[model samples]
Target: MVKTIITLLMMIILFLGGTLFGIDQASEGIIQTRGYATADVKEAVQPSRDEAGNVEVELLGKDLQQVTFEEKEQEFQEIESSNFTQKLAGSMEKGVSSFYNLMIQSVYQLVQVFF
Candidate 1:
């Protein structure tokens, strides 16, 4: 019985390891094929000195212009004002419980199959 249990555990470990490896390989392939892995970094915008000798920097891209300090502050305030942490904790708890239940069920099925 002990030998059988050990064999089962080893098989489960191997299966999980193979699945994870396969997923990692697939994701890497997808990234390479989609050109996501070869993206070039944009050149940094150089700061210019104004008439008053004060250094002024201008954002070069539309993406940079879309993001502002006020927008970030508002997003932060919304998160702080809402029960974000509590909600996150609740969702995480549910996910953990469901995963635990699934593991239990799978183990029970495996035992039944072996017996």
Candidate 2:
């Protein structure tokens, strides 16, 4: 029993260590990618001071785009009126309920047969 317990404890520790190492590597990669992205963005947006000592920034890759408040509000209104999410949620709930009932019935029948 002690040997089994020791083996299980060692397995758990190894599993936890591997999980932590994987998470650390994943996070390090994400941080490095984000750093590169930030560097690229910084290089794209060049900042300079004019003769008047006023700071000016220019985006090199693409033209600056602006979205009006009315456009955003219209989008929000359209999303609210769609009702697609509500319908999808209702369908999913019905499916889950049906599956639950089927599972329960199957289990009950199995128990009756065994008993």
Candidate 3:
């Protein structure tokens, strides 16, 4: 019947569309993947106050810290107890989360065809 044909067509179209465009569903959700991701870096100027009472921002034009990842998953409590890399990563988490949220939202809006 026409209904069955339409259903089959939709299924085929969605399957093809998913293969071409819906990698997000095929992969883990954005939030979950974000947990495994390393933080993005931006060159920035951070203020440093000298002993002689001069305060000025120094430009750090390089990636301030490189991510030295160990395969072990770092936990909140462990970050405080562990070495420099863990602490630095914990500190960067907030900014990275915000950045990811903004980027994903923007892309979602741009790609949304249902509206």
Backbone clashes in model 2, listed as residue pairs: none
Q: TM-score of each candidate?
A: 0.33, 0.36, 0.23
* CA lDDT of every candidate: 0.81, 0.84, 0.69
Clash count for candidate 3 is 0
Query: Per lDDT, what order, best first?
Result: 2, 1, 3
Give candidate 1's error at residue 76 in angstroms: 37
Model 1 pairs in collision: none
- lDDT (tens digit, per residue) of candidate 2 on 16-76: 9999999999977987877754444457776677687666666875544445689999999
Best by TM-score: 2
Error of 1 at 50 (Å): 26
What's the C-alpha lDDT at position 20 in model 2? 100
Candidate 1 lDDT over residue span 6-107, tens digit each: 999999999999999999999889888867563563445755676766666655542222356798999998988898789899999999999999999999
Least lDDT summed over 10 consecutive residues: which range in candidate 2? 36-45
How badly does each model clash, as a count of residue pairs?
0, 0, 0
Pick by lDDT: 1 or 3, better one: 1
Q: Least accurate stretch of 10 residues (summed lDDT) in model 1?
A: 58-67
